[model samples]
Target: MIRAELPPYEGDTAHLRKMFSYFPSGVVALLANVGGTPKGMVASSFTVGVSMEPPLVSCAIRRQSSTWPELKGAHRIGISVFGEDQGEMARQISSKSIASRFEKIPLRHADSSALFIAQAPVWFECSFADELPAGDHTIALLEVHRGGADPELPPLVFYGSTFRQLQVSSADG
Candidate 1:
């Protein structure tokens, strides 16, 4: 059996991204209504069910993010699970210029002021719970206020440095 030689790892940013790319995660849209303008960004680091008793979820944000400050002021934030067909929308929201993130996208908003993509398979309405710095990022913990899902719309998966679609095997059914 031939074993591949490993590169000398420095445990730097480059290596970290390369190694973590092997683990696929769901793509999510973090949205909020800041004042009268819609603000949002795409995150592959979103996680759910962090605390069952408190009903919490979390998303890791870069410490240098300029959007976090404005979003934190919102009364509530929306987390929309991207569908397999929304890869383009994800990139648009994550772009450098935040001015036009939702230019052509359809959106829905809850009474709590949490904005969401109308077609997302699932979405959560949450309020700021807590956050703590972790290395170069801050984990934003949120307490779920309300959420819903549509099983018919399958979620988008971010893996191997690209957006991929998911397929459920018949055996699982």
Candidate 2:
């Protein structure tokens, strides 16, 4: 075995982020209705099917997020997995202006105050289960109360810091 000469890793934030961006992940809208206003944020760190028996999912949220403080107290939170055509929606919700995050965006609200984006490929109404401190972020574990998926709508992908769509191929080559 031969080892290739490479630069030593000094734990640079920029380089670490760039390396992390190589892995593709689906984007999701974590939202809820708080005080009659819709509060939401975009998260690519969402993981589904974490546990089956209790129906759990998780998302790593930045501790500095202004939205999380408002959302954590909500009775329920909505997780909407964006469809391929919803790239612009993700950007809108990710903006710094919290007041206008849901501007011009269609939504469906649950009785529990969970807000789901219209036309999302997948949706989950989750209750806050637990959270663990993870450096600059908190890993939030959510228990899914109810959820649904639309097979016709493919999920939006985030890779290399850009939005992408999935290309389906047959199993047989």
Q: Rate the local accuracy (lDDT) of all candidates.
A: 0.92, 0.93
Q: Which residue pairs collide, candidate 2?
A: none
Residue pairs with clashing backbones, model 1: none
lDDT of 2 by residue, 34-127 (tens): 9998999999999988999899999999999888988888999999999999999999999997778788999998889899999999999998
Global CA lDDT of candidate 2, please? 0.93
Report the poorest 10 consecutive residues by lDDT, candidate 1. Answer: 6-15
Compose the digit string of candidate 1's lDDT tens values, residues 1-173. Answer: 99999877776877789789879999999899888999988899999989998999999999999998888779999999999999999999999977788899899998877999989999999998899999999999999989999999999999999999997999976
Error of 1 at 52 (Å): 1.1
Over all chains combined, what TM-score does candidate 1 have?
Answer: 0.93
